[model samples]
Target: MGTRLLFLVTAALANGVALAQTDVPAQLRVEETRASQLMPILHHLTDIYGPRLTGSPQLRQAQEWAAQQMRSWGLKNVELQPWEFGRPGWHNRLTEISVTAPFQAPVLARALPWTPSTNGLIVADAVILMPPGMPAAGRAPRRTADSIQAAKGGVAEPPMPKMNASPPLPTRAELLAYLESQKEKVRGAIVLVGPPAAPEPDFIPQPMRRTDAEWMALINAPPGIAPGSSTRPTVEDGRLTRDEINATIAEFLVKNGALARVKDGGERRGLIRVESTNGYGATPQVPGVTIANSDYGRIARVLQGGTRVEVRMNVQNELHPDGSTAYNVVADLPGTDKSDEIVMIGAHIDGWATASGAADDAVGAAVMMEAMRLLKTSGLKPRRTIRIALWGGEEQGVYGSQAYVARHFGSFEHPKPGFAKLSGYINLDHGTGRPRAATYFGPQSGAAIVAQKMASFRDWGFMGANTASFRPVSDSAAFYLAGLPSIGLYQDPFDYLSRLHHTNFDTYEEVYEPDVRIAAVEVAALAFALANDDKMLPRFDANDIPSRDPAAGPRARIRPPENHGEP
Candidate 1:
């Protein structure tokens, strides 16, 4: 009887231990199964609030809405943190572009952000001037009547003009000279200053769908290096930067009586790709539009074939002056014992107006918001405060996040008390896909800690974690540079780069509901684990981190494509 009783007790104890081990995953599973909650929140942001361009009224409205939502969920200290984004605010009211001469057709286009109004309906002759040195199709090797007859008689004709032979791009001086010579003809015309729109290829490179091994490798790699990592930028020789060239061209166009400037939207199909100006706090001198590549190509070919073209442009855009204040939405779930220590999760709230900015960042913002909601509703109290920051002006230059970092934790170049109190930061900005892994951008020592924490949710698609010491390309960059542990979630690429990101196609329809649900659950679980951890994540020595070259200021780096906005 005694032996039988002992066996029963041992069996009960084993069962109890198994149940305890499964508790976290069980909660996470419940969260994932109920992940559908994200869809409505995403809809409210993308469908109802729409595009949240930085410094625009719409963005402010969205920020207010987000804060109110957080407050409703019982989050503490929910507020809009204001920052001075030096750039002027812009909003598009109306835009209409149509070809009038050669053939009448409506040309689909969107005014680039911050582009000035056309004043009134500006109907002008369209002049296609190839930026100096772009090859003009050489006159097909002159076909003589004898050569034509020979070819007709099955004999090979004289070799055609070398179609590929073209001169090197002209120097800045040469470009200016060419424009000057054409002053009489170009005055008051709508100049097509865009490069020749290349024909769409049969296949475009796609983002690698992350495999299990690839995801695991990312988590386990050391800092400052990862698969497909590129070398840091260095100061260049005397050649003028692309921004300089563009600025010069813009100024010249405005000075020379140009009505407006039109460029081919470098997007697949006829989709529009919009971008903002490069000015720190100014608007473009003249109106600019990015038209569909197909339409732009048609106009260019007509012009090249010696046919006259005329276009009518009507744009109404408003620019709020400098000193405009943009905001970052902030709220926190207060911690118990370690309230002073912080674990931050953020996503940029600002995006271009081309679409509703759904995939580019709305999904990111929604994921963070949903994750916070889950933690609150799950009745789990954390040790360190969990803060959610939805940053504005990220599309501009990571301005909002940088300002927040500077104000709260001091600049990356100068550390403050709050900087050390930061346990770590995790950012989500890749897209609407589920989080498969984590990327660390600080000390390599922290990778082990992250890996151990992430191991708990391995079944929830926690592949692994990795480290790098490069400057961040996202909001976490500020924290990373400040010597705090920072991480970004690596997500599956569900056509984010191929079709939806920064284009008109980035709408609510493109969002994968199931994936977003999984993302919210994963993000919430990670935040919970990080905040509840007993020890703060380790930081690396500044010397160990790869510092930006002093001479190579922000301008020297290879920036994302204009339409990419901010990562």
Candidate 2:
């Protein structure tokens, strides 16, 4: 009887221990049924607030709305963290481009942000204006009619072009002189540039997800530098920089009373990509617009055929001179035991002005908000405080997160009070797709812990984790540079690169509901696990952190297309 009673007690203790181990995560998962709550937040951000350009009014309003939402959920320290932005805010009010003379046709176009308005409507004759071209070398060898006939008769022919021929590039002086000669032609005329060749249809299909083999290859690949990681401006032999040359051209056009500059939309399939002036604080002296490729091509063809083509351009843009203050939405869910330590999750709230900026980042912000809500409602108290940061000015150069990190955690040379207290930071900015795996910026040990914590989420598309020093050029880099452990969740490709990134097509319709909800649950589970872990994730030694090269100029700004290549 005593032996039987001991066995029963042992089995009961085993079952109790198992339940204790699984209860929190299981409860967290149960709370995730409320993950659908993310859609309303996303809708309010993308649909109601529109594009949240850095330093713009819409972004400020969105920041306030997000803060209110967090506070209502009983979060602590919910506030908009302020940062200084020297530039005035800019947004497009109206843009109309049309062919008036040759045929009545409306042109699809989007105004470049920070460009001046056309006052009202300006209708003028269109002129093709291309930047001066470099001089070419010797011409290709010609194929005579006799050679053509010989080839038809099965005779061998000589190679067409002379591969040995080469030519020196034109000097800056020559190029400027050629541009000076076109001043009269562009005076009072609408200038059209680019489309060196007409766009063709794309037949290749875009892959939705990276295969397990591809993911493993990426995980095990050697440390590679991300594009635009260097912050230096490119200057050719100390000559004029590209921005300087463009500024010279723009000033020249303004001097000649050019109506407005127009260019191809830079992508096929009628998608418009709009960009701002190179200098963040400076506004363009002359108005500019990027029109659909088809419209641009038709107008160029008519002018090439010696027929006079007239176009009408009407643009209205608002510049808020006082909109110099940028804010980041920050809030905290207090912990019980290790409340001094912090675990962070963040996403950028700013985007380009071309579209609603839904897929580029709004989905990320919504998922983070939902994850925090899930942790709070599940009644699972973490040991370390879990914080949510919605950053601004990411589209330009990740200014918001950089400023936050600098204020809270000092640089590699110096350490701040809060530096030692940070457990880790996870940033999501890849796209709207579900996270497939995570990449760590610290060490392999940290990644191992993350893999173990996230193992239960395998069915949700999270395969595993790996150690990688270089992270995608997102908000996480700021923390990584400060010697803190940072993790970036790599997501499936979906249509982010092909259709939604920084284009007019980045709207709510592109976001998939299931992907985002599952992503929230995964992030919540990981955060809960990490917060309650016995010890914090290890940080990189100061020596392990990469120091900036003094010779490189201020970190180069991130242009979405150039910087967001696959890891």
Candidate 3:
């Protein structure tokens, strides 16, 4: 908070008028270590059922398991509501890749999510060339039109582009970066990869944050970074063509998967998290991590520079048709006097096929579950019905919530009920950080007193309401699009993100009990207060309309076609 606001807050506290601190009872203790009955429930969802990839058999099993668990929890009307989605499923079984020839050390690699695995140890000669320019596998000659044109100019015939070019594994980090840099067009080599590592906000920034062994190695330079391990100080020599980089990564994935190559220790390691793992492409067959120039030189000398290297790898996986039988786990805490009105809290249950969906949403789901579980267990029934929705197919889009809104708020496209008797919506989807209040979509004045109370969670030192403003991104966006005011709560993404997030590293070990407990209290307290409060969160009264016409509109405007072969 700014100085003036702090002063105002201080002044308000001194007055003792008790303005907006209505969300929690003065006696509620929101400290870390507060245990919930639902903790074990969340564990089973994450540990037993594992990753609930949308549409997969195991995913379906998980969905059913979630519903059953909720039913066991005594939730009413618990059922798996079916919806259509992409068919089939796939899961990895075997991933083995090794480099043969000049030198060899185990390498770090992974397979793209949803990629067809090679049945056995496939072998191929390594080739390191850029995209749309490298020739197909095993084709000795560059006879393309461009090659001919270049040859006439004595332009040392450029390496032919890959005709048998297979899809590459793209990372979430790269995709987000590309989108940030350009929006006019988003294309490159096709990728079947998974979410990349979201950088850890703190440890990653600390240069000396490495272990004693790592520090010694960095300082000595005698014993270079351990095999398949990376060292500090990454640098890019010159501006590299984005297309070139994309091709390089793509080729790396193909060759690595086919046992053509293994990446040197020039790349960084992956992070693991509790309750979740970004397993999208966490295998020894995919590509994203690249070797450092110094080390890559060794492999380049043999592969790109002509010496042939032999590598072998095997990828085994199962395939399932894409089908979407959507389901949202919903429960109710009926209100005494205002049972008709509703207060809703939610977090998505579906996760990236790669992750365990823990932090990305498990924490959020757990938070939502624990909030209601705490209220009910504590014998604190709400004054208005409190609804909890663990939505399905959220990763595919807000299909679950959208379907709810479209049906519950009939004429949603035309606006009949504006909201679903929704006093407000509170959502959590960020990784398992501590409770840091929330970000809303309104002027400070609108939530003035509430913001003050929200900040009170800060008293615990781990929880504080930032009162920052953020547009909708998760399921809340569906509500926001329907003109309902929503609040997105978050914790410090310091470790939860970089450490676990969506990688295979996302495991139960990564969750900080103190942090998760802190979050649970804050979220429950917020829900309880909101349920008992008199006023509803402010809504967007100005120009609230469906973003686009269902029939057709500017949103569906035409775009120029891609010039396939043109540079």
Which candidate has the top score in TM-score?
2
Off by over 4 Å in 1: 1-22, 133-169, 199-208, 217-238, 280-284, 411-413, 548-567
Sorted on TM-score, highest at the top, how do the candidates line up?
A: 2, 1, 3
Q: Against the correct fold, how does model 2 do in TM-score?
A: 0.86
Can you give the TM-score per candidate against the true fold? 0.85, 0.86, 0.64
Candidate 3 local lDDT, 485-509, one digit each (tens) = 5677645554443345455556566
Q: Who is ahead in lDDT, 2 or 3?
A: 2
Which candidate leads in lDDT? 2
- For residues 1-567, could you state the per-residue lDDT of candidate 1 as single tens digits? 145643554455446533232244345545445444687888888887778788787788889999999999999999998899866777788989999898999998888787888978988888887666643220122255654565456656557675565455566777787778877776788888756556433232444367787666655554433333333333245434445556777888878888888877755477776765657336346788888877888898899899999898899988776328889999999998999999999998888888898997999999899889888866678889999999987776677887888888974457888987888888988777777877676665676777777676676566777675334566766675455678888788786755676788889998888778877777777777888887888876645644445455432223222223222
Better of 1 and 3 by lDDT: 1
Candidate 3, run of 10 with poorest lDDT: 558-567
lDDT of prediction 1: 0.73
lDDT of 3 at 311: 50
Cα displacement (angstroms), candidate 2, residue 445, comes to: 1.2
Q: Is candidate 1 or candidate 2 better by TM-score?
A: 2
| C-alpha lDDT score of every prediction, in listed order | 0.73, 0.76, 0.51
**TM-score of model 3 (CA atoms):** 0.64
Every model: Cα RMSD to truth: 8.4, 8.0, 15.1
